[model samples]
Target: MAEGGKGSRSGSDSDDQSAVETNLTATVNKVDGLEVQLVLQVRGLKPKGGLRSFLSKFSNHDNPTDLCANAEFTKWDVTSSSLSIEICVHTEKERKKKKGKHDVNTVNTETFTYKISNFPSEIRPEKTTLEIKQPPGETSYSFIVLTLQRVDKSVSWENFRTPRNS
Candidate 1:
């Protein structure tokens, strides 16, 4: 009975995840003329420094990590069009002035780009998850999640209707 209970619980958890994914797709793929937005949410990060690096999995809803990227375009414009996201994060050097010793962690700015070429023009909505990798040395963080979704909008008059006492 305990085994069966665990199986059911896992099944329900998968169901919940599937439902959330479905809702995200529905939200992005509606009304052919509205707009398609690329939202970058950082799930985790680790500043590279050998074994001393700390992995940060951000879960703060109140203060989210700024990915510094927001790209939006029309449904028709974005359809079948190539998209490239290039971001550069620079970390300055920190000086430790204790006991006349200076420890500097100077990380340079890296402008890395990830591109999606020729998005499918089919009527079916598509979703793709990409991993933005960080170079081996002198970079801010490594291993980030990037979700790509295209929305189609077919505007309706009901959206613009005002309340009336007919």
Candidate 2:
């Protein structure tokens, strides 16, 4: 009975270690690809309430107005020291008037474009500020951001890189 317990414990420990190794190996493999810039532009519009309310309760507010863009480098093979991304904004106005309806309603449409690449600078430094605001009664929401993720190229490569950091 004592021998069986010891064997089971050893097997469990080995399994745990194997799982950890597999996860680490997978993460390293993901980073081996050439790094590319990812420009993620997020905009907030007035809440169109429905089943979406259950999922995004926070976005619903009376005065909703704010937009943000985030930049990151990933999804490639080259190891780059710098990254750059660009965000562009455009607006369109639509007039809605009915022949037998009450009045004309104007709709404002906003569009954003993201240009991502691996470089050393930003396309528009003034527009790239971390904080943005909308006028009047400003209702805003922000998100937790992630910068970078380490990728392992090879076990041999990691062995050398790990010692340099220490």
Alpha-carbon shift of residue 71 in model 1 (angstroms):
16
Global CA lDDT of candidate 2, please? 0.24
Put down candidate 2 lDDT per residue, 1-166, tens digits, no spaces. 0000011111121112211100000011112332212212233223223465344444532222222222221221222332222222222223445687543333222322222233232233222222232334533312211133323323122211111101
- For candidate 2, the per-residue lDDT at 76 reads 18
Q: After superposition, how far is residue 132 of candidate 2 from its true place, in Å?
A: 14
Highest-lDDT candidate: 1
- CA deviation > 4 Å runs, candidate 2: 1-53, 56-101, 119-137, 140-166
Give one digit per residue, the lDDT tens place, for model 1 in 35-78: 33333321112333333222323322221123222211111111
